[model samples]
Target: MEAIVPGPDGEGLVETRLRGWVDPASALAAFRFARHAPSAELAPYLDHHWVVTYADLAEPYEQRIVSHPTVNITITDDFRRVAGVIKGGFSYTMRGSGRVLGTRFRPGGFHAFFRAPVHRLTGRFVEIEEMYGGAGAALVAGVLDEGDMGAAIGVVEAFLLSLEPEPDPLAEETAALVSLAEEDVTVTRVDQLAERAGRSVRSLQRLFRDYVGVGPKWVIRRFRLHEAAERIYQGRDLAGLAAELGYTDQAHLTNDFTAVMGMPPSAYARLGLGN
Candidate 1:
């Protein structure tokens, strides 16, 4: 088994939503990250596959992530588990050298693979075997033993295909709704999103709870915060951003940004200046 030795992770290989990194510049220096799409058969349920490899650091580097709303299944030496949408921020520390192969399921897409409501996994990490029994354990072992990154991902994809993804119209609708919340900056409130989707606010809430693992409001604000991070890093005006992103005021935006990035916009902007 040969480990993957790769060059710097280029911007095109990563997603823009990865702005959740507390210090995007530093995070890039510390690790190599790339995302790949799943097979055609698994496309409906998967966002894409991701590979992270890091090595030869003089000291351990901790990376803070302002988690996305989707679920991820990560296989690495540190742990092999299923992680649901974290309602807040989280961190991972890389030491010596290591690699991680991950599967990022689309918003609402995991429901096709999970038996219960998607919310059950929110803010939680479950051992893969706990969810899929022996087959799940096998995936962990196969990925761990395989040195080649591509073959490792192939093992996981084979396991996912064996699960037999069954498409649900509601799940597809939920994915579309999440995309709208993420892509449309004008959408500031859940009610606005509900109206756009032609559903009452209450019904919309039900759909998100059942499929997205969080409310539409959280999704909309989080995506907006992602945009805010990028703009602020570029030295944009916070007051103007708050208005454009639907925050009641700059303070509200600050609270959300602080909670996720572990710092307010002003401080984050200063760090951005160094980059």
Candidate 2:
């Protein structure tokens, strides 16, 4: 079972299924991961309702995630928070048995629910209560107590529906633009994106900061790096990947990959092979 994503404008590279998991085979082995569709009403704002469950593990499993350029609302025994676009990789450890439920918001779709500039949440994790107050706390408790996985998702969907979020065309536009940045490898530079969007580079940056929670360049590079990881894991050449991803040189690409992924492309490939 693979997660197949479409390329730019429904065309281009479609090889990436595991968007940015450092090791998909190992992560799948570590736990049970599933994605459920949100209700029609909430579809505009959410991408999916994802759940990870594991039971009776003999030892702790740690997974490194090269997170996406989107906000996430995660509820679990340890914490319930609105997570921002993590600028770099992060890790989570699981032991024994437990469940983690999350709502992955579309690139700009979170603005409807938070009703504030989304950039403030970038690289930050705020307790749901801090933003949603008592109502947020109640949401955590309600979902945790719900035994049925689908029912728990329903609990969250219903809460979002109550917010009465109206569709924002700008949000939709932002999501689409973000998609272009993601799927269109040709869009390696922020200026190129601004040109495509018919906005000045400054205007494009402002739009991204307000809606996408990061500058356009950051988003562009992140997606490229995601592509790089997927390709390298498939045993692609490093020099070719660097050139294709718009790095000044292979070393530049290696530096960037090592910085975010904690290893060079070659080492990452070897680890994937080991798994």
Candidate 3:
């Protein structure tokens, strides 16, 4: 698989690290996953472009994906739409041979394209035709018909170029704050994020609700859970890991993990280790 990277004028593909897979090796063996960067003009609004392909096999492979704070536009053999934040783990079964192409919008970036409160899209799916009319449907058909990945990406780039929305300064600022929360494990509280962003707690909440479709606290907790999944896979001590992740204690950590993952950390670790 090619690593995702920035190309001239933001046309290059970037590398992606898969997370929340039940069996990483098995999944990798069963599918081909790749990611590409949006054109420079579209980078502010898009995180990256991703494509997954697999051939028909004896049994359909069931893949479980974790939730993120951003929105996505996905196109498959017969489906197409803009999807909002997935609240929890969801499974997609790969049946007959086919490809699925998707664009993950940066946190808060969809606001520019939607021109409405992003919170309205949370946990919802909007038809592409509703947003882009016949043109959008044509784009989908063109991409599906094109067998070349590069050509398909070009079609998507052209589509975004046609709907270029005015830049949203607040979307950029919100993206910066969300990036901090995702990368810094020490950022465990919304109050801390507010202080860092030079805003009050209520102001931060409103900003996130308007643009990100989720609260600051939810972002922080979700990021920590992502960290937990990784550390548990590496066989880290749950007690120390809990303290490090800013949970009240191990029980609290386990409770949160179980709620989202549908399994305790210990069980997940075993699955990760292929035990």
Candidate 4:
């Protein structure tokens, strides 16, 4: 459930923003390609890692039901070459659809979530038949396959892991923002968050939008909804739960839940815990 986040080395953290992460131990890495495509834009920065599909949609396209900050496992009928940023989280791809396969990461300055066989290590996206255990092991195998950049990969991996996951570096403010929002559903002002993060309101908003693909207010609302959903799914009384979650009333909660989840709380309870 570990994701290897890219560091400020090699490309030196170019603003282009193709974030990918692999577990140091290679527990589970997610390589994601993201661009602001219509269908693609709906998927958000999930708290857990998820794998979704990339394909051509026909006319009368409908937006995906699942909300952002949630994982998606995409399915497509044909092959396609995709371009976008990849980010990782602490979860495995629960299910995959269609005929697509996972691919491996090769030596040539490759940033893979996991290792794959050299022969099958093509650039295009396909399912990886075999997965390497961790970054080090994957690098070693990739080095054996292709002689160049083996040592450099090792050094880079080492350097990335050695760096502290703290301080003002690497947008530490994001952690704070997440913490504050997760604590309660009470609406928070952007200016308040900016003050707490020691950043200007505009800068914080921009950072959240750029990295999370959603504005701060939206993120907060989603978090609140997630909590409400969890409670309702756990057999909590709808009216009481709504009040506890800071909703004005049961009707208020119901409208919001139905809007976001595409179903009422009662239906969700009958279905399952997660959406």
Clashing pairs in 2: none
The number of residue pairs in model 4 that clash at the backbone is 15
TM-score of 1: 0.93
lDDT by residue for model 3 (105-170), tens? 999998988888888888888888887899899988888888888788889879887887778899
Lowest-sum lDDT 10-residue window in model 2:
7-16
lDDT of 4 by residue, 25-111 (tens): 221121222122111211121122122332332322222222323112222233222211122112223233222221211111122
Better of 2 and 4 by lDDT: 2
lDDT, candidate 2, residue 32? 70
Q: How badly does each model clash, as a count of residue pairs? A: 0, 0, 5, 15
lDDT of 1 at 137: 92
- lDDT over C-alpha atoms for residue 191 of model 2: 91
> Taking the tens digit of each residue's C-alpha lDDT, what string does model 1 give over 81-117?
9999998889989999999888999999999889679
> Candidate 2: deviation at residue 25, Å?
0.6
CA lDDT, every model vs. true structure: 0.86, 0.85, 0.83, 0.39
Best-to-worst order by TM-score is 1, 2, 3, 4
Every model's TM-score: 0.93, 0.93, 0.91, 0.42
Superposition error at 213 for model 1 (Å): 0.5
Deviation in angstroms for 174 in model 3?
A: 0.7
